[model samples]
Target: MAQKNYGKKLLLVVLGSTVMGIGIYLTIIANFGSDPLTMFWIGLSNRLGITIGQANLLVSALMLIVVFFMDRKEIFIGSILNPLVISVTTDFLLRQTITIDSVGLRMMFFILGLLILAFGIAVYSLADFGRGAYEALVFSLNQLFKRSIRIFRILCDISFAIAGILLGAQLSIGPVMAILLMGVSIQFFINHLSRPIYHYLNK
Candidate 1:
């Protein structure tokens, strides 16, 4: 029984994490804008002349170090799996993007990307694997500042977005929309989706 549960949990973790990768990929291929963290990763990729997935993993690894020092407990299997899977998934999807000539279609992709991203995040989180490096960073910052995690998250997004823009990453109203909506959207999912999922996993 426990064995069955573990397998299901692992599958959920992988699927949830990979869906997140797909969402990020769609947002990038849309070429409108991306979430700040993604935008920052893209900037790193450009400046470093590596794939965006490579840059994302590199940053996640670096953040893991910081989180390790701040709170070791925050690091979990999901922390490693989350970045590794997403990195691979993103790079794999990179070659799959098609050239879209229609603005309306592009906007639809962008919107779909945002919704998918929120759903992926919520699902991944519900898997009970662990916090990713970025999530850990938010937790650590909240502890350090003794403020709201939501506030720190938004601030982090804004900071990363600015840095990404400075590094020649493109900007659009997209990042703004992401910043404004992501937390709310995640909560919306958690509110609606968590109970059923948690029951299934016995979480």
Candidate 2:
């Protein structure tokens, strides 16, 4: 059997998603903006007469369409729950403020927030329950281009970020950091945690 059991995988998915939401909250708190995907959702929500949460739902729906065509299996499970979980979870957590009254405190939260996001994604992938929308799309692009996952991720993220910015999506320090750091962070955390965390979760 795979080292990670189904129950453990489910737990990790929820945990990872929760962390992703926290990271979004941190970006909002930092006042430094969020990633392109996030910015796109927020902007779409604002302009299209939808709540940010609802906008996220819409984005997930569109991505699921692409994902189903690109990799039917990967989209199969996540399509059912990942977007709904991420959208609702992020909205709830981000709405709850973690008040920080100082610049130093805010900066600290920013860095910590990034790390939390990394851990969440790492756990989510390590669990291997299903692929997140962004991750799945990057993997699909890599397969299509016959390129490395890392390289493809970087390229896609940059392209998406630029596009989101051009479309009047929020683009600032937090998002810039996310664009630069998310890939490396996810890679690092996944590599380091996959086996050990899986083993621990199973047992």
Candidate 3:
């Protein structure tokens, strides 16, 4: 029974990680601003002359350093898998496809992508495998400040976005609004779906 449960948990982790890739792809397709980490990857790629996937791998490797220092428990197999999967996924999504080009089309894709991303996050969070570096950082800050995780997440995300902008990353109203709105959108999904996912998996 214990082995069975462990296998299920492992499967959930893999699925959750794959869902994360989908969320990232959706973020790109939305043509709005990407999440802070993606913004960082894109910014660094532009500044340093690396591929986006390579930038992501570099960032994820550095994040592993922080994860080891701060909380090893939060850093597990899925942590490695998530970035690797997303990089490949994002690369494929961007290169092999022509995304919506028109302003209205882009806006629609952006909104729909946000919702899909939120759902992916909700599922991933509920899987109870491990938190990504950014997620772990938010959790750590919330614990340290005795503030809400959601608020800390928002603050951290915004700070990263600003940093990306200053570092010569692309910035427009779409991405700026993402910094403001993503937290609320994610919180809504978390609130509505987290419990059900938890119970389903735990059972």
Candidate maximizing lDDT? 1
Q: How far is 49's C-alpha from truth in model 3 (Å)?
A: 2.8
Query: How far out, in Å, is residue 73 in model 2?
Result: 2.6
The candidate 2 region of ten consecutive residues with least summed lDDT is 74-83
State the local distance difference test value for candidate 3.
Answer: 0.71
For each candidate in turn, the TM-score is: 0.95, 0.84, 0.82
- Estimate every model's Cα lDDT from 0 to 1: 0.88, 0.73, 0.71
lDDT of 1 at 98: 85
Candidate 3's C-alpha runs over 4 A off are: 142-152
lDDT of 1: 0.88
List the candidate numbers ranked by lDDT, top first.
Answer: 1, 2, 3
lDDT of 2 by residue, 101-169 (tens): 898888777777788878877877776666887777777777777889979776766776676677667
Model 2, TM vs. native: 0.84
RMSD of 2: 2.7
What is the clash count of model 2? 0
**All-Cα superposition RMSD per candidate:** 1.6, 2.7, 2.7
Among residues 3 or more apart in sequence or in different chains, the pairs in candidate 2 whose N, CA or C atoms overlap within 3 Å are none
Off by over 4 Å in 1: none
